[model samples]
Each structure stands twice: as C-alpha cells, then as structure tokens.
Target chain A: SQQGEEDPQALSIQEGENATMNCSYKTSINNLQWYRQNSGRGLVHLILIRSNEREKHSGRLRVTLDTSKKSSSLLITASRAADTASYFCASTLNYGGSQGNLIFGKGTKLSVKP
Target chain B: GAGVSQSPSNKVTEKGKDVELRCDPISGHTALYWYRQSLGQGLEFLIYFQGNSAPDKSGLPSDRFSAERTGGSVSTLTIQRTQQEDSAVYLCASSLGPSGVGTQYFGPGTRLTVL
Candidate 1:
C-alpha cells in the first residue's frame, strides 16, 4: 500500500526559480524523507525530517514535516536544469512491525528548463 | 565506500520462465529491502530483511515471488513462471540497520522485461 502521495504529478519551471512539492501520507510517521531519481537511474537520498522537526535545511533543499497534518513538503531553491528529475517522498511508520519499511509516494516529475 | 550493487542491469525473458535478480548491499549494512517500479508508477515494496531476523514478505504481490538473503549480505529475488505483469525495474537498497530513519542507498536496479 502507498503511504504517501505527492501533489502536482508534474511541474515545469524555468531555471533559477524556486520549486516546491507537497506530499501527504495516510498514517502517522516517525520520519519523512525525500529522494531524487535521474532518468534511468536509482534514487538518491536528498533530505530527511523527523516527525518533531517542523522544517530542515540542507544546502539548497528544505523539508518540512507536520505530524498533525500527516503532510510534508520539499523546496528546491534556485532550481537548475540539473534538478530536473523525479522527486519521491517516503514515510516511515511510527511503530510496530512496519517500522523498518519506507513506503514511497508516486513522486512528482519536475522539469527545470535552462 | 562502495554502494549497493545489482546484477544483470537488464534482463529480457519469455513468459513462464523463471528469473532471479541479485543485490549486494554495502558492507556492514544490516538492513536490505526490495522494491519494484512499473512504468510511470511509484515503487511497490516487495520484501525486507534485517540482520538475523525472518524477512518481512508481506508486501510480495503473489506466491510466485520469493527472496532470500545469505549471510546478511547478498540477497536474491526470484520470480517463478514469469508473466508480462512482472515486468518492471527491481530495485534493492540497504541502510545502516533496521531503523527506517537511516538513509537508504539504492542500486542501479534490474530492468526485467517479460515477453
């Protein structure tokens, strides 16, 4: 079952603009993480935000998590053509046997035009 | 440090023929996971293994799918009587341990094509 769903299935933006993607999950979680996948490549971990953390910053990336809303958002500042890729949100359940599994969202396809 | 590695990056096989895909997680990593992504779809969890524990096979779609991890290092996913619907990119990942909060490193993936 999918634990997270990302808004804006596809987004096209011009270079240097900021791009934001939103993700909503179905259950309570311990952490929310973002990953990026280039064309025909495996996913790369971008950033992670704990349930208690309202927001976090990693270089040009920012992630915000809201346990109450069961939602999270990823922001890419000064988007570049190199940022063109699929972004996925994965949520880890708060407790129980499913704790070790990372349920992934369908992802948002972002295109940054140079 | 070497990252996760998957074997036979691409495989094309006939329906009803069985196929096995392999994954080698990073050294010292104790948690490994398998997932499959169909065209234009997000990843679907297949199974996961944590050091010395029975694998969690609840996510497997059908009885035809089975996986095993040996010595808690390399793992293999086997699909019996392959069908067209089984075509997808099978990905493998590993983290430091059983904690989901740890970062997962993924392999390039095995693109299985069933004809």
Candidate 2:
C-alpha cells in the first residue's frame, strides 16, 4: 500500500515560475525522497530529506519536511519547461525496518507552459 | 558506472499468455525492486530482492506475478496468464543497500500492452 498522497493532482504553470507540490504521509518516516517522471517514462531521483533534518536543497530543488504535521513539500525554484513532469513522494513504513524500496504516492503532474 | 537497464523496452501479448521482463541492476548493487505503473497511475510495488534473495513478496498484487534475482545482479519478473489489467509499465530499480538514504536508480521500464 502507498503511504503518501500529493495535493493538486495536476497543475499548470508558466516557465520560470515557481512550482510547489505538497505530500502528506500516513505514517512516520526515517526519510522522504522526491522523484520525477517525464511523460510515461521512468523516474529520476530529485531530492531526499531525512527526518532529522527539516530542509534540504539540491540545485533548483528545495524540500521541506514538517514531521510535526506529517507532511512534506517540494519546491522547484525557477522552473523550466523541462521540469514539467509527474512528481512523487516516497517513504518507508517508518516504524521498524530500514527505508527500502519506497511506497510511492499518486503524484502531482506539473505542466510548465513556455 | 551504468544505471539499471530493463528490456525488451516494450512488449505486447495476448491475454492468457505469459511474458517475462528482465532487469539488470547496476553492478555491485545489492538491492533490486520491481514496480508496476498503470497508465496515469502511481507506481505499485511488486517485489523486492536483496542479494539475490527476496525477503518481501507481500507487495505482489497476485499469485500470477513472480520474480527472481540471480547473483544479486540481474532480476526477472514473470507474469503468468497475462490479463488486460496487467498491461502497464514495469519499472525496475536498484541501490547499494536498503540503508534509508541511498538513491535507487531506475531503469527506463518496459511498457507491456496486453491485447
């Protein structure tokens, strides 16, 4: 079963604008990772934020985790048309085992219009 | 240095037949995973194997789905009695370990279309 769900099932944004997608999980987690899928292809690793950490940044990607609220958000600053893709948040069971192959959410589809 | 690879890229089979999808994880990676993605759908976990042994088969949706990894390198997902609903993109991923923080590199995926 998937443990997380993303809001705004689909979104349309203009190029160079900021895009924010939110994810809420049903359980605690050791860490949360974000992934991007282009068209109907495979996934690309974007960023991962650990529970011990509140925020993480990589290139144009920014991830914030609010463990207190059991939610996380991914922000793509200065988005490009290439950033148009389906974004997913994944996490483990968060209780006993290691964070293995994640349980993924339905994902948020962002379409960046040039 | 190579990422995960899955083949034959795409497959179209009639219902009630059998099909096999293969995945070759990055060399030396000890963890392999198989996920199914239906059209406009989230990834559904199918199986997980570590070091050529699967400790979790609970993710498989049905008994018709089975997978195996040999030498902790290449893994194959075999679907018996393929159904129309089984038509989807089968994705494979691998990582060095289940260590809560490593990245799982994914393959291009095999798009299966059942007729």
Q: Candidate 1, overall lDDT?
A: 0.90
Interface RMSD of each: 1.4, 1.9
lDDT of 2 by residue, A1-114 (tens): 578999889999999999999999988787888999997788998987888899999998899999999999999989999998999999866665542768899999999999
- Report the error of model 1 at residue A7, Å: 1.0
C-alpha lDDT values of all predictions: 0.90, 0.88
Ten contiguous residues minimizing lDDT sum, candidate 1 chain A: A93-102
Model 1, range A1-114, lDDT digits (tens) per residue?
689999989999999999999999998888888999988569898998888899999999999888888899999999999999999999888887674778999999999999
Model 2 chain A lDDT-worst window of ten: A92-101
In TM-score terms, which candidate is top? 1
Candidate 2 residues lying further than 4 Å off, grouped into runs, are A97-99
User: How well does each candidate superpose onto the true structure, as a TM-score?
Assistant: 0.96, 0.95
Superposed on all Cα atoms, model 2 deviates from the true structure by an RMSD in Å of 1.5
* Model 1 docking grade: medium
Provide per-model DockQ scores: 0.71, 0.64
Give me the runs in candidate 1 sitting further than 4 Å from their true place: none
lDDT of 1 by residue, B12-87 (tens): 9999999999999999999998989997566987888887454567789999999988998999999999999999
